[model samples]
Target chain A: MPDNLQQALGASTNEPTASSKSNLKKLPGDLAMWFFILAELTVFAIFFIGFAIAENLNLVMFAEGKAQLHKVAGLINTIALITSSYFVAISLHSMRVRNDRQAVFRLILALVFAAVYIVIKLWEYESLFEQGIDIETNTFFTLYFLITAFHFMHILLGMVILVYMAKNAYQGKYNDSSSESEFSGFESGACYWHMVDLLWIILFPLIYVI
Target chain B: MMKFWQRYALSWGWLIILTMASVAIGQYFQYATLNSVLFIAIVMLIIALKGQQIVDVFMELKHAPSLWRNIMLSYVIVVPLIITLIYI
Candidate 1:
C-alpha cells in the first residue's frame, strides 16, 4: 500500500501498531531538534542567572522596575501559555495514536491560548511604551524587554510551526499509526511550543514577581 | 495506569492551580512584611515544581532515557536553587 493510504487508514482505525522500537534512548521529535531545545534552554538559563546577578547589584532599581510591571498581565499570560502547553501535549499524543481529527482540534485549542498570550503581551508592551518605557529606560527594563521580546519571537515562530502542523493534520499526513517515525514535524513543533511555555513559566516569576 | 484524560487532565489541573497559587503568593508578599530571601525561596520552589511538571508530562521526558531525564530534572531543581541563592 502507498504510504499516504496506510497513514490515512491508520488514522481512521486509531491504532499505532506501526510504531518502531529502538533500544537506544528516544527523545521526542528529531535528535537535532533536541539539541536545539537544549541550546535554547541553556541560553535562557544563563540570561536568568545574569538577571539575578544584576538584581543583586542594584536591588532597589530592580525592585522599582519590577514594581512598574503589571503582575496581573504577567499572571494571565502565564496561564495562557501553560494552558496552550497542555493542548500541545494532547495534540501530539493524538497524532501519535493516529487520531488526526483529535490532533487538529487540540492544535486549534492550543492556538487559541497562544493568541491570548500574544494579545496580553502586546497590551503590556503598549502600556509600557505609552508610559515612555523602553529597553533604554534602565538596566532592568532593558533586560526585561530583551528577554521577553526574544521570547516573543520564539512564540511567533512556534505558532507558525503549529499552523504548519495543523495544515498537515488536515491533509491526513499524521495518520501513520504504524510509524512514529514520520511525524517528526508534529513532535518537533509541539516540543518547540512547550519550550516557549517553559521559558515563560520561569520568566514570569523571575521578572514580574521577584 | 490511568486513562488519557485522567493523566493529562490531572496534570493540567495542577498547572492551573499552581499558577493561581504563585500569583497568590506574590500578592501576599506585596502586602505583608516578609524577608525577601524567604519570599524568593518560596517562589523559586514553586517555579521548580511547575517546571518539573512541564518537563515530565508535556515534554514526555519521563519516558526518555534515565540519563536525559535526570539531566532535564536537574535543570529545574538546580537552576531555581541557584537563583534563590543569588537573591539571598
Candidate 2:
C-alpha cells in the first residue's frame, strides 16, 4: 500500500511517528551564539558576585544606597523587559509557523517595550545624577553604575539586533521553509534579547529591592 | 495540552506575577514579620524561579541538549544560592 493511503487508513509505517519526531531534541539558535551567551553570562555573574561581596564589606553603606534607588522605577523596568521578552518569544513562534506578518508585528511590540525600559532607565540615571550620585560617589554607586550601565549597553545592542531581525522578517527572509542557518540567525538574535531580560531579573532584586 | 503560543503566554504571566510578588515580599514582609535572613532567602528563591522560566520558555532551551540546559539551569540555581549565603 502507498504511504499516503496507509497514513489515511491510520496504519503505522516504517517512517518515524510524529511523537518520535517531536521527541528528537534540538537546540534553538546557532552554536556560536550559545557560546557568546555563556561568555556574557559569566561576566555578569562575576559582576554580581563582586557586588554582593562589596555589600558584605560595607553593609550600612550598601543598605543606604539601596534606599536611595527608586524601587518603583526598577519594578517598572522589570515589567517592561519581561513583557519585551514575551513578545520576542511569540515573534519567533510566529516566524516558525510561517506567519511573517504577525512575527513582524510582535517584534515591533517587543521593540516598544524595550524602548520603555531604556527611557525609564535613563530617567532613573538622570534623577540619581541630580542628587549628586555618580560612578565615583562611593563603592555602592560605583558598582551600581558599573553593572547597570554595562547592562544598558547590552540593551542597546539587543535593540539593534531586534531591528535587524524585524526588517529581515518583514522581508520574508525567515520562514518555516528557510534554511536551517537562516532560521538559526533569527533565533540567535531572539536568544540574545532574552539574555538581557534574564540578567535584569536578577539585577533588579539585588540592586533595588533585596 | 497547551499550544506553543499558549505556553508562552502562560510563562509570561508567571514571570510578571513572580516579579511583583518578590517586590511585595521585599517591601511589606521584610519588616512586618519575616526576619532579614528569611526575607533575603525568599527573594533569592523567587529570582531563581524567574530565571528558570526565562531559560525554559523564553529562550526555548527546555528540550535542548542536556549539557546546555543544565548549564543555564545551574547558573540560575548557583547565583541565587551564592547571594543567599552572602546575606545570611
Candidate 3:
C-alpha cells in the first residue's frame, strides 16, 4: 500500500513483535492526530479567554446572555457528545479485537450523536433569532454564535471522516487479512470526536455555568 | 512512555482529572492578572501533556522514523511557547 494511503488507513506493519501483540489494549493509540486535536483546543481556549475578558468588562451582559441560552439544548448536546465519546471508546475496544463490524457500528452511532447535537443546536439558534439576538447584536452574541458555529463546522468534518471509515469497513478493508492497526481511519476518527467532546466540556461552562 | 506510561495508567484518566481540577479552580477564583497567567500556563501544560501522550501512543510517532518524531516534537514545543510569549 502507498505510504499516504497506509497513513490514512492507520495500519501498522503486520509484523507484531511478541511484546507488542501480547495483551488487551488499555488505551487508544495516541497519534499525531492529537495535534489536530490540539489546534481545535487552542481555538476554544481563545474563545474562553474572550469570554473571561467580556465577563470582566460587563458581567451583567455576560450573565444575561448566558441565561438567554437554551439550557436543555445545551444539556442535550452535552449528553450527545458524551454518548459519542462512549462510542469512540467502544470503537477502539472493538478495533483491538479486530472486530471491524462492531467498530464501524460504534462509530456510526457516534455520528448519530453528532447529528442530534447539530439539530438541537439549530433549533436553539432559530429560537434565539426569533428573540432578536444575533451575531451583530453585541460581543456576547458574536462570541456565542462564533464559538458554536465553529464547533458545528468541526462536527461536520468529523461526520465526513466517520462516514469514510464506515464505508471502508463495509468494503472489508478490515477483513481477517489485516490486523487492527492496519486500519488507522477509526483511530483518527475517534481522536477527532474526543476533541469535539473536549471543546463542549469547556463550552458547557462558558455558556451555562458562568 | 509508549510502553511505560501506557502500562501505568490510561492517559485519559490523567486528562480528565487535570481538566476537572482546572475547571474547579477556574470557578472558585475569578481571573485576576496573576491568576490568568498561572491558569493559562497550567492549561497549556495539560494540553501539552495530553497532546504528547496521544502522539506517542496513537500515531506511533515513537515507532516512525526518529527524525520525523524529533522534528514534530520541536514544532509542538516551540509553537506553544511562542503562543505564550505573544499572548501573554
lDDT for each residue of candidate 2 in A1-210, tens digit (9 for 90 to 100): 122122212212223356744454566777889999999999999999999999999999999999999999999999999999999998987776667899999999999999999999999999999999999999999999999999999999999999999998888876434344666788889999999999999999999988
Residue pairs in clash, model 2:
none
lDDT of 3 at A153: 90
Q: Where in model 2 is the C-alpha error above 4 Å?
A: A1-18, A21-23, A176-179
lDDT of 2 by residue, B1-88 (tens): 5576788889999999999999998888647966888888998999999999999989877767788999999999999899889877
Candidate 1 vs candidate 3, DockQ winner = 1
Weakest 10 consecutive residues of candidate 2 chain B by summed lDDT: B29-38
The digit string of per-residue lDDT tens for model 3 on A1-210 reads 233233333323333455544331222334566566656667776776676666667767876888788766776776676666666665655555566788789888988988899899999999999999999988889988988899889888878887887777767775534554545555667667666766675566456544
Candidate order by decreasing TM-score: 2, 1, 3
Model 2 TM: 0.92
Q: What fraction of the reference interface contacts is present in each model, in order?
A: 0.65, 0.80, 0.00
Per-model DockQ against the true two-chain complex: 0.58, 0.62, 0.09
Candidate with top lDDT is: 2
Give the Cα error of residue B18 in candidate 3, in Å. 14
Q: Which candidate ranks first by DockQ, i.e. highest?
A: 2
TM-score of each: 0.90, 0.92, 0.63
